[model samples]
Target: MNTPIDLRSDTVTLPTRAMREAMYHAELGDDVYGEDPTVNALEAQAAAMLGHEAALFVVSGTMGNLVAILTHCGRGDEAIMGDECHTFHYEVGGAAALGGVPIRTVPNGHDGLPALADIEAAIRPDDIHDPPTRLLCLENTHNRCGGTAIGPEPFRAACDLAHRHGVAVHLDGARIFNAAIARGCPVRELVAPADTVMFCLSKGLGAPVGSLLAGPADFITRARKNRKMVGGAMRQVGVLAAAGLVALDQMVDRLAEDHEHAQLLAHGLAAIPGVHIDPSRVHTNIVIFEVTDPLAFLQRLQAEGVLGVYFGGQMVRLVTHYGITRADIEATLVTVRQALRAA
Candidate 1:
């Protein structure tokens, strides 16, 4: 237990030395005035990489999501999303509280896309009693659905369906690079169909802070104002954006290692007597397994120096990120063996 294996989440990863160096050397400017050269450069890079007309740097994934929801929908309107989506389950209900947007959920399919029929059925008609379907949100490498990646065809179908209903699509692409790698695709290709997209620099890429929201220039322009209204405006923030630049340039391609580690963990955990998960569901960098007594299971893992998160009071999640290594995975397996034997 001398050294901890922090599999709690990818967001816990510390910046690499190269990222630290970039942060120290980043040129500073007034970001509120849009004069931060480094921030501007990073946003432009992200936008181009994602095939979007423009991008905005936000403080966190929650802020990025909240702003996007508010900006995309009218008050009393609705956005359709996965029932277990990060925006719905983890973002503290900011959309409902601040945006007055009703979140209509479509049950998540095993592959993480809402069933086409379910999505279509969830859309409201032009009736006065029902709220308008203002937007549709998609999560790539969906977190709660065992990190499943939505393939291009499925994504295109969903986008096409949403567009037919005159609903814009916003992607909460928190782990999109993982999805891109898992699918042997590029981030731009996965996000191409969505009208607006947000990806986290802090999650798998190991940036200390920030998420990028990209869309058409006009949408980004409105998002900027929405961010300001929510008190997300900041000054001299290029310091953090510098590390995000490092994440974009250097941290993306290495996500294959995390995915490999996650699959390894999933397969190993599946061998345990009490762990229940279809290892085939371990597609990306997240391993979610059901445990009979998650609190006891988590305590045993923590006592053994392997840490993770428990969801829905029963499912436990182990996420592999830039910080976890193959050797660490081996160590984790040994610890799991010991914990199970002792239990």
Candidate 2:
């Protein structure tokens, strides 16, 4: 096995033996007919946990988000989301390309929630020229904002603003468990303000595949059809759902440890020369820091078997997941100092 200590993202985590065992024993049926008992159970579990009336299993966070956008907006309708959101920056503009939903971006606050004024101003009136603002999206533990978790004040403000304008709010809660663990709240508390939410089983939860989109039963039915249209309809999906079952049950609480490890890494990095970070804002598994010449920095770190991604310019992100240990993080911290010294 390689000791490279890849911290590029939490998505690299492999399913645990326990999760694989569950997958091996899962009783499967054709999910296209909605008869897969294991998949049904996983959807039900996700719906209950997120305080939603129903849930649908999709192949990835990107798929879940695209389906939600398609279900909420008609052709030429607009989706109001943060400029820093994954849907806008990444995800290949699928909503606009395939669903015909235009993107209207708002700047994100430091905590990763959209500025309420910008969102309110962006809502189109009942005019013929403007694309109707059909939906507002929120990304909890907002990825580009150094994994800043959404708080009640900002989340409530955004949800209330969108709902007051008769627009639905959908949460891109890909790593919501990380946010909930740090805030000492249940996942529902963070996601309840939104009309719909999607969380990943594969990312930090250590499952091989699958994401759950939770919403009202009627909305979920539409999302399921949209999912099928986009090649997300799997027949014997219970194999993946079984691992997600274990992920939901056994992986939710353990996220606190990952957060702890991230905080330690952030603090340790800040102590090193040429590294800049604010450890106070690291409330989850992601620690994004800045160093001079990040491209050169990453290359030097790579020689020592440390791997992470450069987030444009001098910024880089390191994510701690179940696959990384305390010893690994400590070694990573030591390696960072060496990399800086060598720079």
Candidate 3:
């Protein structure tokens, strides 16, 4: 039987051969004691790439975001984010449940950014009644927004708005490398406006596991403690960091291939009957489209060995990743068209 074309997410990607080799031979020490050479190297590389003083290696993107949030906000403080952001819809509300930080939501435009005015209005006043807005969270290549890349200018504007109000900005930049590749800009330029950033190595980068939370050295020092509180501290975890290092070195530039495949997928999906999508809005590897009967459509696609996830309501999401090729994308388009007809 042929291998199924899995488009559910980039998280399903397997590590490269180089990544496996590196993981096997990785130098190890107790990471909790700050003695893991490989883990230390991964963290330092991530910080330098994001233009931050330091970074903390965490098990997943969710944990990285949670650690950053915990470091930035105190109990009863609030965080402002886009209504369509991954942190608002996903991440399981860890910020509120564990850190006592409330999330305030503002409208996200098609371009994947909350309007500056909307963010300004959401800030809590000095009054004792309302929770102070302590953090502004942003997502690049925003998931729900069809992986739209947030460029530097608007990103900087939003960060400046939050900063003027004394609110720290934390970016959920899980697919930031994708955004940078799509916009033809450096990754650091995209994240420079934010106070902290959490990026996933497991997603488009194709590492088996790990995410990094980068920020000021003091913030990372506190985040390391919070990581322990959340059971994210691991001993001798350089094995995982080794894969992340290989991902950083080998997987970043090739994100352009995934972006190209996504554009191809989006345009192909647009041509299909009973499918709704704006190919122009697809900026990275994520492709979101709506069908008349989402359940029936997805079921048919699965039966045909084309896998995609049903996103809320009538929407479905597919992602292009390291292992997916143009041939696979072409086959997926054919399968989707057939599935829609059958549905």
Candidate 4:
């Protein structure tokens, strides 16, 4: 049997040999006591990279977002977010369920930006009947929006609107590095406007686990309490943080390679009959394209040792990552072509 080309997501990426070795020798202590040097280093690095005063390591991206939400908003407060964003659509309503935070949804444009006017209109006035809007959420390299990179200008404008209205902004930047690479800027520039940001080391960075929630030191201090209340405090977490440090040091610059492979895959898929994609819209590693029947198309590809995931409707999502090479993209294209013929 041949190796399967798993294009389901960048989260499928395995830890590198360096990461494994780092984990093996990582100096460990109790993270719950804030004594884990490796975890502390990872948090400090992530905070500085995002231009924040502090950061907290969490179990997953979802947990990071939840902690940010709980820290920023009290019970019965509302959060504004893109309807199609990861927090609203994919986070299982953790904000509402766990934190008693209600969500206000604004339409996300095709480019992954919520219209400034829509965002402004969503903020609740001093009404006795309406829940106060406490937070504004944004996503970069938006998952449902063909991994589009929301540029700095639009991002700043949105955050500015939220800030003026007394609402803090929280960015669900699970793929912020990809957005930074696509826009040819530093990650700090992309994240500077956000009051809080949650980024995943387990995503495109290729770590096995852990995400960071970054903000002001005071905000993170509060979030740390919320994290413990939610049972996210862990001991000896330096083993995972060690890999995260390696990811930050070694994996960021190489994201451009994943972007290149995504473009190659998108262009090839666009040329294949029955595949529907605009290669120009593929800005980063995620390529979302349409097909006649996504499940059947994905099944055929899976049968041929090529794997991708069927998103809702006619959408199929393919993500390029560290382990997937240029050769793998070429092979995947060939396999997809054959699958189309078989259909």
Candidate 5:
């Protein structure tokens, strides 16, 4: 039987051969004691690449974001974020549950940024009754916003406004590499303005698992302790860190291929009757389209050996990753058209 074309998410990507080899030969030591040479190297490389003073390797993007939030905010503090961001919509309220942090939501624009004015307004006043606003969270290549890439200018503007109000900005940059590729800019520039950033190596980068949180050395020092509090401290985890290193070295530039595949899928799907999407709005590897009967469409695609996930209501989300090729995109388009007709 042929392999199914899976477009559910980039997280489903398997590690590369190089990653496997590196993991096998990786130097191992107690990471909790800061003795894992490979983990230390990965952390150092990630910090240097993203232009930060230090970085902490975490188990996943969710944990990375949680640790960052815990480091930046105290009990009863508030964090402002876009309503459509992963931190607000997807994360299981770890900030509130574990850290006693309250979330303040602002509208996310189609371009995947909360308006500067809305963010400014969301900041809590210096009143005894209100929770002090401590952090502003942003998502690049925002998931719910159809993977729109937020460029550096708007990112810088938002960070500046938040900082002026004495609030630190934390970026949920799970797909920061994709955004960098889509914007044709350096990843350092895209991440420069934020006080903290959490990026997933398991996503588009195709590592088996791992995420990194980067920030000032002091912030990371505190985040490391927070990670331990959250039960995220690991031992001899350099095997996974080796894969992340390979991902960083080999997988960053090829994100352009996934972006192009998304364009192809978006344009083709838009041409089908009763399917709605704007190909021009597709900026990265994620493609979202509306169908008249999303359930039936998904069922048909499953039967046809094409896999994707529903994004609530009539929306379906497809993500192209490291192994998805032009052929896969072409086959997926054919399956989508057929499924729509059958539905």
Candidate 6:
């Protein structure tokens, strides 16, 4: 049988040959002592790319967001986010569990942005009864919202509103490069208004591991300590940083191909009678659709060597990534059509 066309998530991506070569030759030192040259270089590169004064490399996007929350908010302070955001649905509640910071959720529009008015209303007024709202968390290419890429103007307005309310913004930018590519904008432009932003190297970028949190120098200093508290500090980890550096250098522009493949997949899925999807809603690399029997459909697809995930209820999510070719997408569509006909 053929290798399964793994469309479950971009996190399943394998690093490229160039990334393997870089990892093998990476310069190493103890990152805990801040002496890892390759790691330092990756952080500096990420900071500059995101238009921030500094950056911290963390084990994952979840850890990076947790460290940012720990650094930005004191105990008992609240952080606000979209109800459908990855941090709220995923991430294991680290902010509240570890940092004592509670999260308040605002409804996310279909386009993956919390309404500015809703955000403003969620901010706590000065009162002894309310937990101070200190942070507003945003996601670009929001995972649970069918991977919708929030455009720059609306994103900037949301950040501006949070700032006006004395709320710092933390962006879950795990797939931000995809958003930038989809919107035809520079990555810095999308991230400029955020107080701090975390982007993953492992997901769409195809790095083997790691994410970077970029922001003001002082904030990063505090985040560094928070990282240590979360046991994210590493020693001789430049090998991983080297792959991340290669990912940043070579993996960004090619994301457009993944976006195209996703469009093809979405349109093809929409054509199938039993599959429900709006191809126009597919702005990035993720394709989410509804089926009458998600589990049965996934099982049938898996049997035919196509793999996707059953997202809650009747929703199914398939992510196009570095290894998925246009040909693979066509094969997936054929399989789906056949499955529906057989059913």
Each model's total of backbone clashes: 0, 0, 0, 0, 0, 0
How close to the true structure is residue 141 of candidate 3, measured as C-alpha lDDT?
83
Which of the two candidates, 2 or 4, achieves a greater TM-score against the reference?
Answer: 4
Which tens-of-lDDT digit does each residue in 1-343 have in candidate 6?
9999999999999999999999999999999999999999999999999999999999999999999999999999999999999998889999999999999999999999999999999999999999999999999989998889999999999999999888899999999999999999999999999999999999989999999999999999999999998899999999999999999999999999999999999999988999999999999999999988899999999999999999999999999999999899999999999888878
What are the C-alpha RMSDs, in order, of all predicted structures? 1.0, 0.9, 0.8, 0.7, 0.7, 0.7
Q: Model 3 over residues 1-343: C-alpha lDDT tens digits?
A: 5889999999999999999999999999999999999999999999999999999999999999999999999999999999998888888999999999999999999899988999999999999899988999999989999899989999999999999999999999999999999888899998999999999999999999999999999999999999999999999999999999999999999999999999999999999989999999899999999999998888998888899999998999999998999999999999998988776
TM-scores for all predictions:
0.98, 0.98, 0.99, 0.99, 0.99, 0.99
Q: 169 in model 1: Cα distance from truth in Å? A: 0.4
lDDT of 2 by residue, 155-254 (tens): 8888998999999999999999888877777778878889999999998899999899999999999999999999999998999999999999999888
Could you give candidate 4's per-residue lDDT for residues 97-175 as a string of tens digits?
A: 9999999999999999999999999999999999999999999989999999989999999999999999999999999
Write one digit per residue (lDDT tens) for candidate 5, span 89-193.
878999999999999999999999999989999998999999999999999989999999999899999999999999999999999989998998899999999
When summed lDDT is taken over every stretch of 10 residues in candidate 5, the lowest stretch is 334-343
Q: Among all windows of ten consecutive residues in candidate 6, which has the lowest summed lDDT?
A: 334-343
lDDT to native, each model:
0.92, 0.92, 0.94, 0.95, 0.94, 0.95
For model 4, the local distance difference test gives 0.95
Clash list (residue pairs), candidate 5:
none
User: Which residue ranges in model 5 land beyond 4 Å of their true spot?
Assistant: none
